[model samples]
Target: MKAVLPSITSDLDQAERDLREHGICLVSGVLSAEQLADVRAGLYRAAKLDNRRKLAHSGRRIDHGESNQHVRNTLSLDPVFADVAEHPAALRLVRSVLGWPALLGNQSAFIAMPGCEAGRLHADQGFIPEPWPTLPQGCNVGWCIDEFTEENGATRFVPGSCRHHRPPGEGDEEGSVAAVAPAGTMVVFDSRIWHRTGENRTSDQSCAALFNWYTRPIYRTQENWFLSLNPRILEGASDELLTLLGYKTEGFGKVNGRSPM
Candidate 1:
């Protein structure tokens, strides 16, 4: 199938337009079928490895132990996951959302299966002890690795909710919409928007690769990815890749110190 994306200039213009109108934008076919398959396989392998270790240590019998109550598995453990986390379309979307010079904060995955409970509705940065009515700190890219539908636990968001002084409530239900997209598609949204993972009703599981990039330098990430990076991966990565991975001179200025000129 052909890749679904606008040309670079068109994408930039469209992205800004989308952000101005809608709090989120759905970009389709960011990943090819082969790439999607590879990511899924890598996730499965990671999940299996974790499950095997859990079972071996617990000595308890379990059915489908690989699945979790909220998110089944995380992609941070997979090497190939780094590629998906730094995809070009994803970066463009981030630039549009945050107005560029953004820093990559965290990279992870969420796999939801049937019967999983619905996630709580909250903005990601809320975890930080900050003042109310904060500025837009960052944006997130949710890659639909599996087919996501309303019945299959698609992501739900309140459009233009980012403009609100605070998080939305039950009264904001009218504008909320479920972002149902096909596998290989991606949904990029403001980190401050009110959103939740919808409950999965299908028997099969729904998986998503979530990459969050921040506009500012001080924010903490959901995933401690710096520990996961190795020399091989770093050497092969581009400068943009390194910047996205939190390797920047500005952010480390105080710590790195200035030379005596």
Candidate 2:
């Protein structure tokens, strides 16, 4: 019901606590100024290239004039993207909720262009059947590349909605609040939390965030790394990166009843 989510500056312990209590939290100053600029530039460049290649994703709400452009292949576009994906605090929080075997489900740019309609209110786990389990099966880490404000379409979330154990509906919009934070903050939340992009009222500024989704190992990943990952990345991937990508199989993911690694 508050105007914004709770935030902690450079405190991993508080971040985990916030996630458990509020279902969402912002970790400020997670990225340096240089990192912020580089990642932002990489996102735009990848988006431009994808647009040119007709591979960009724009979810059009025709009647509502929503044309949010999403760049889905950021992992293959730049090394900076990869660097951000492995951010220590972000990954640690992810593992704390989803466990050490959590797999990186998807990493993409969530951009709200000018005049865009607010995104539909729903939980990230909406795709899965309800009544949901008490423990989260997945989580989202949204890296704010640009300072988020109400005017420029910061993401909106329903605090403590994770305990609802189900997806939100039409009347659930009343208590939602925008996640307004400075650039370089990482907005992390449980998959069951109700959230969506707020409307972008600004004429020129576009709210951009790199969203890295992590899931429990049992679920299928949103992005198919085997088919979509760049060969160069695979060739040089560390053991941890490989594990995150599902290339390093564990108990259930074994190939021919044997570990891939």
Candidate 3:
């Protein structure tokens, strides 16, 4: 079960190399101190708004068994969230793993609270039936708003597991390591890698992580952008944003054989 730990680097070239060889890479300093602070605050603000709405309707927590809060459809929650999703650093890595025609599957907040239990270990592409292709069908970018540490529920990854063409089984957890990195780092990993959220053992601090997931254009996105994005956000989207949202026509997204864009 022994495996090499994921490579951590500030250089994109090194990160790309790690991704291809190790299945995971941590790109340090993807955000400035000020930017990280703003995103951290934005995450809580969005959580508060979502909580208020849920409380009004007696809604149960989406993460029922986990000691964490989930904020879905973050793009329309705040301007900062949209900025996080469209960050140049993230887009570059995503396209590298998932191809230029990648569509943003979703942008959401994963706030792991103190005492949170470790999550179910699995690959992001597990839904796709095996034998899995060598090429990844998706990529997941984790934006670390708070310093990620094993004590604070950092994600765990089984290094080089992306090379496995099939999903993990009963004993795969033995090889995993926590993806420790500083605040403002961006964690880019191939969706085929086996990963899970580590347990939060801290007394007070919550791990504020934002995940922007992308997929090949042939697959439908997790969030239905057409129905969920705020109208104003759509109106003001850049051409690249539109393309990521699946507004631009690729080979399969055509409407009656015509380009949607």
Candidate 4:
């Protein structure tokens, strides 16, 4: 649980090194303030839209910090999100952990509203059976919008716990520390890491944390991009984004009567 925070200004090679050593690396200053502003605007708007829909159907809010919201399938929610999800540095880092042909496994918003409690410590690939700790199937990139202070629910992780190759039980987690960083920092971690959200102690601030998860091309993504993405959004997108959406795979979809490459 000791936090081994490497210098976020390290080059890509060092960043990748930290990922291997600690199972997570907080890359500071990856996103510019302007980029953060654009995404935050879109993110809040999308959250409001989603909140209204959820309110009508569930008669309850998602969480409490300010509507403690976790919005899955954010790739299609806003163009700014899409841009960040496919950012060059993030994709390169994820590909280092997953592979050159990695696909976008999932994208979502994890808003820590004030009073939002910590989530269970877990690996992103928490449910694959029998395979045990086979090969790694994922890597996650957290695009932090607001600064991640211990009091504002910064994620916490156990250093080098990925080597355990199995989930840590409640008794196993000790010395956990928060992955603290300023706003616009990008947190990249191996999916096998033992980590979870920490409690948001603030009374009025809601933290906006966006997660863009990637995995091998063969594994299924959490969000079905084909179904969720608007046709306009998909139309004429760059080849890279298309591939991340699993359009590069042969079995699941075909375009123009031929398999997408």
Candidate No. with top TM-score: 2
Give the C-alpha miss distance for residue 149 in model 4, angstroms. Answer: 0.3
lDDT of 3 at 127: 81
Worst 10 residues of 2 by lDDT: 58-67
lDDT of candidate 3?
A: 0.82
In model 2, pairs of residues that clash are: none
For all candidates, the clash counts are: 0, 0, 0, 6
Candidate 2 versus the native: TM-score? 0.93
**Per-model lDDT:** 0.61, 0.82, 0.82, 0.77
Deviation from native of the Cα of residue 258 in model 3, angstroms: 4.2
Show pairs that collide, candidate 3. Answer: none
The residue-by-residue lDDT of candidate 2 on 133-200, one tens digit each, is 88998999999988899989888888878888899987998888888888898989999999888899
| Alpha-carbon lDDT of model 4 | 0.77
Q: How many backbone clashes does candidate 4 have?
A: 6
Pairs clashing in candidate 4?
1-175, 1-176, 63-68, 64-68, 65-113, 65-114
Error of 2 at 177 (Å): 0.7
Of the two candidates 1 and 3, the one with more favorable lDDT, higher being better, is 3
Candidates 2 and 3: which is better by TM-score? 2
Better of 3 and 4 by lDDT: 3
